[model samples]
Target: MKLTLRLGKRLNRSWQVDAMLMLLLGVFGAFMAIPLIYVINNAFKPLDELFIFPPKLFVRNPTFENFGDLLQVMKGSWVPFSRYIFNTFFITAAGTAGHILLASAAAYPLAKHKFRGHKVLFTIIVLSLMFSPHVTAIPNYMIMSSIGWIDSYKALIIPAFAFPLGLYLMKQFMEQIPDALLEAAKIDGASEYRIFWQIVMPLVKPAWLTLLILMMQMLWGADGGSFIYSEQLKTMHFAMGQIIQGGIARAGAGAAVAVVVMIVPIVTFLLSQSSVIQTMASSGMKD
Candidate 1:
């Protein structure tokens, strides 16, 4: 009877701790949401009301005039806003697809196959992730310029395809799959490509989704500001910059554009496999 009581007390304590942790996490999530709330709230307010002293959390005169103005600009641009959106979409899609395909292919060999200098190759790939893009920016730009890829989609998309982080994440996820499964496939006369596509790929779907979310976020916002600023081939962020420079009338319009721009990715992320994000978060805590 005493032992039973002790066990019950321990279980109750664990529940209490979990409840407290959840409450803390809820508070942190609200704090993180504040900035997004602020941007959205201000996006609907009139320009005159925007700079009001003490600031209004709720707009007394919410209007869609800003959105209207932005739409007009988008419709009338010599280099249409649609073009910028298209460029961003294509580059992001191509880069992400390439990353997933190449990373998965590269990781399979590194994770499952035996060959000469495989360890060296894997080590180099892992080490490459430590090297920041900023450190290589000048060299990369020079190479792009030399190859005549500046202000082109190739410059943006091709360089991004070599994603070390994606490769590393895939390798880690692939390791979690049992080797016996692959060997069994081999016994059944399955090719390596078939084994990878049919068997391994499905098991790592969570990791793939996580990488997709991450890559989409990065590529969708791929301004790099200094690199891709040419007028002929400006990205969405660069177009927003141009709108901002057009002065106060366009300020509200710019904010409205930004709000819309921000929503697309956020909604896409939330809608596409949010469960994977939760799984990844839980996994991180375990590690």
Candidate 2:
């Protein structure tokens, strides 16, 4: 039997090379973990240690005072800290769910079915990815203002609903689904809706789970931008920024805030990392 050249049998040609590569990977992994370790250590460091001459990688004397300070700062805010937490959760959930559904729905026909102007439509989506979000900020603000969505959660959630990258990823992943599977379902008396919801969507689980990580990172970091004016509507990220900007006194508290803000996105990635790895492995992408 012949083996496919690209399916990774190449890695087994030399055991010594494999051992060397594993060592190399372990070294790189440790390097990558440095920042995460530093953040965790810094958050627990005392205020005095934070200003040491050359700084330290690890905390010599750890303390929970920073977390306590964070709590006090949260309590000092006029808006309840829970409100900011709620707003962040709501926006992240709503935006992520909507983008997944909308992108998956739009991707279905584009991936499996041919239609008029399909190529043109997909071209536009691809083109949109070339521009950074900052380039669209002014236009997005104008649209939000005109729609009276400013100062509301709609300003935050609605703008992220039509994420082009989500659709791009979904469509690419969906293209790998064999059309024969859908045809088999059709022959079994499944409607188009049933085939999509049950067949296509489930097969693309990795794709959306990966998309969830991406969307969570974006929405989790949202800071109300220029649209939100209402104090109650601000996200936890926006509130954290306020707490982080209190100069030298807030240094420890700022480190604590960084840890807090990173929690959700890191957790989301950890939960979905296997799916993401599966998706990437099957993607057949090359450098």
Q: Which stretches of candidate 1 lie over 4 Å from their true place?
A: 1-18, 224-232, 273-275, 278-287
Task: State the lDDT of candidate 2 residue by residue for 1-287, as single tens digits.
Answer: 23236665562346666688899999999999999999999999999999997989999999999999999999999899999999999999999999999999999999888999999999999999999988999999999999899999899898788999999999999888887878899999999999999998998899999999999999999998598988988999999999989999999999999999999899889999999999989785432
Q: Write the per-residue lDDT of candidate 1 for residues 145-217, one digit (tens) a residue.
A: 9998877788888887787999988887787778888899999999988999999999788788888888888
Candidate 2: misplaced stretches above 4 Å? 1-11, 285-287
Judged by lDDT against the true structure, how good is candidate 2?
0.92
> How many collisions per candidate?
0, 0
lDDT winner: 2
lDDT, residue 30, candidate 2: 99
Model 1: lDDT of residue 124 = 94
Report how far residue 203 has shifted in candidate 2, in Å.
0.3
Candidate 2 residue pairs in clash (backbone atoms < 3 Å): none
The per-residue C-alpha lDDT of model 2 at residue 55 equals: 83
Each prediction's whole-model lDDT (CA):
0.81, 0.92
TM-scores, all models, native as reference:
0.87, 0.94
